[model samples]
Target: MARKWAGTAIVIYFLILVFMYWYLFNGDTSLPEKWVGTAADPATFLNARELMLSEQYSQIRNFMFFAYNAFDWIVYFFILLFGLSRVFERVAASQSKWRIVQAAVYLFLLSLLSYVVTFPLSYISYNLSKSYHISTQTFSSWMKDGLIDFWVNFGQMVIIVSVLYWLINKSPKKWWFHAWILSIPFFFFMMFIQPVVIDPLYNDFYPLKNKELETEILKLASQADIPAEHVYEVNMAEKTNALNAYVTGIGANSRIVLWDTTLNRLKEKEILVIMAHEMGHYVEKHIYIGIAGYLILTFAGLWLTARLMNSIITRYGKVLKITGIGNLSSLPLFLLVTAMLLFASSPLSNFVSRYQEARADQYAMEMLQDKDSAITMFQELTRSGLSQVNPPLLVKWFRYSHPTMLERIISVENYHTVEK
Candidate 1:
C-alpha cells in the first residue's frame, strides 16, 4: 500500500511540475502602465529586454518554489514509509541510555540526511541566481555560507525537537498546548537575539560608514518617534546585488540595518524613504502584532497537529512501523504533519504579512511626504531584485509577503499625505 501511494505521489508530483512549467512560461510578461513612474525616465524604467529577463527569472523562481515544496513532501513521506526514521531511532538509542542524548543523536542524523537530500535543489537555486548575475558570491563563499546555514538550522531544530518530545512524553494529550506556551517566550527571545547574535554570524555588521547619510537616517527615525542612535550597515555586496533596508531585533537590540548594496545603489533621498518604511514597522508596532498573530496560529496548528498525529498513528502505526505518538521513531511523522500544516497555512500567513507591509508602505509615504522618492526606490528595488510586479495569482497568494511593486508604486502615485 505504501509503495502504491508512493508511485501515485511521484506521478502527481511530475504532473504538477509539468503544469507549472507551462503556466510560468506562457504567462503574460507585459508591464502594467501603473508600474511606470510619472517621470517615465529610462533609468527608473526597465526596458523590454530587462523586463523579459525579470519575468523569466521570477517565473523560474516560482516554478522552483512549487518543485521544492512538493519534493520536500515526497521526501518526508518516503522517510516514514521506508521506516528509515525508526532505523535512526534504534541507532541513537544504542549509543545512549539517556533519552535526551538519544534525541540529540537522532536529530543530528535526521538533519544530516535531510540536508543531503535537499542540497541538490538548494545548489540549483544558487546556480540559477549566479547565472542571472544576482548572486556575487564565489563557489567557496557560497559553500561556506551553506555550511553555516545547515549547522545553525540543525542546532535550533535539535533544541526544539528535544523540548517537544519531552513534553509529549510527559503528557501526550496536552503536549501541544504546553509546547505552544513555551514557544511564546521562545519567539520573543529569538527576535531579541537574532540581530545581535545569529545575523552577524553570516556577515560583517558595523555602523554606517557614511556619517552624513547616517545622520539623515537618524533624523528621519527621530521624526518617526523611533529612538535610534545609529544606523547599522551590513556588507552584503560580497553575496548578492539585492538592495534592502529593514528594522530588526526587539527593544535595545532593535536597529535599522541597510545593505551596502542599498547605499551604493540608491540616492540619499531614496535611502531615507527606505529608512522611513522600516521605521514604520516599529512605529506601528507590527513586530509585536506579528508575534501575537503567529502565536495564535501556532496554538491552533499545534492543536490540530496533535489531533491528526494521534489519528494517523492509531490507524497506520503498524504499517509505518511506529509504536505511538511518544515513540522516538515517530519524529518523522510529527515533522511531516507540521510541515504540511505550515504549507497549507502559508496563504493566510502571507496575506496578513502583505497587509502589514502595505500599511508600512503607507506610513513611509505619510511620514516622508515624498511620493517621488518612494516610487523611484521601489522601481530600483524591482530592477535590482528582478521582481515581477504583477506576479501570477498563485505565487502572489502563497509566496509574496508584500504588495507587488506595481501596487506599491501605484499607491505612492495616488497617495496624498495630510499636511503636518
Candidate 2:
C-alpha cells in the first residue's frame, strides 16, 4: 500500500515540476513588443533599452525578489490550509457528532472576537490618516467602510471553506484534482468580476459628467484606440487623500476611474501622464500577463501540495490523533508546510513585483512620450500617499514594488542620455 502511494506521489511530483518549468521558462511572447518608444524619437527608446539591460540580470530584470521569493504566494496558501486543518482537527476530536460543528462554531466565534481586538487598531490607523489630513472621512464613515470590506473578505473565506468541506465529504480521493480544475476558472472569474461587481460595493461612482475633463481623457483614449466611455469619479475623498486612476472592469462596464483626490490634486499634464501610464498597462496587456503569471504560480503550489499532503497525513496522523487521511483535523499539518515555504521566500518576493511595475512604467513612458509629466505625477503620488521614495536596498528588497525614487529618475534620465 505504501509503495503504491509512493509511486502515485512521485508521478504527481515529477509531472508538476515538468509542467511548472515549462510554464515559467517557455517565455514565448507573441503579444505586441510592449512598444516602449515615443512617436518622435525612436532612437531614445533604444538607447534607454541598453541602459535597462545593464541594470538587469537578463533581458528580464531579476532583482532579488525574482531570485528569492517568487514562490511565496504558493507556499503561504498551502501552509495555511494544511496546517490549520490538522491543528483544528486534532484539537476538536470528539466522538460526538457535534464535534465538527462545535469546532466550526468556535472558529467563527474566534474570528468575530479577533475582529473586536483588531477594530481598535484599525480605528487608530484611520484616525492617524485623518490627523495627517490624508483622510477626510469621519470615524463613523470609516467604521461603515470597514464593515463592508469585512463582509467582502468574509464572503471569500466562506467560498474557500465551502469548497474544502465539499472535498472532504464528497470525493476525498479526487479532491485535489478537482480543486485545481475549479481554481483555474475561479481565478479568471475573480479577474473578470472584481472590478465590476466587487469594487462598486464599497464606493459611490458616477459617470465623469465633467465635460472638460471627460473630453480631455476621451481624446487620450481615442489615441490609444480603446473604447472606454464615461470616466467615473469615485467618492474616495470620503476615505483618504490617496490619489488613484485606473482602468477597471471588462467590456461595456469598463472605464477609467480617477479618485476625486487624484483629479483635484494633479495638474493637467500630470493627470495626462498618469492616465497615459494606466492606458499603457491596458495597451500592453500587462493585466492579462499579471493574472496569468499568478495563476501559474498558484497551480504549481497546488500540485506540490496534492502530491505531498496525503502522504504526510497518512504517516503522521496516528501521532497527531487524526483518524484518516481525509480527516478535517489534519489540515493544520498541511498548512504548516505551505506557511514555512512562504516564510522562507518572503525576503525575495518583492523583486518579481517590482519587475512588473518597472515594465508598466516603461510602457507608461512609451504611451505618454513625456518624461516631465511622468516624473511629476509619480512624485506627487509618492508624496500624497506618504510612500517612501527611496529606502535602503534591503528595505526595498523585502517591501516595495516600484523601484526607489533614484532608480526611477535614472531610468527616465536615460531617455535623455544622448543615445548611449
Candidate with maximal TM-score: 1
Give me candidate 2's TM-score against the actual structure: 0.68
The CA lDDT at 59 in model 1 is 90
* Tens digit per residue, CA lDDT, model 2, 135-237: 8888788778788877776666557655765675677767766777788777767767877788888888888767787888888888888787678888898
Alpha-carbon RMSD to native, per candidate? 1.9, 11.5
Q: Estimate the TM-score of every prediction.
A: 0.96, 0.68
Pick by lDDT: which candidate is best? 1
Cα error, candidate 2, residue 245 (Å): 1.6
Q: How displaced is residue 317 in candidate 1, in Å?
A: 2.0
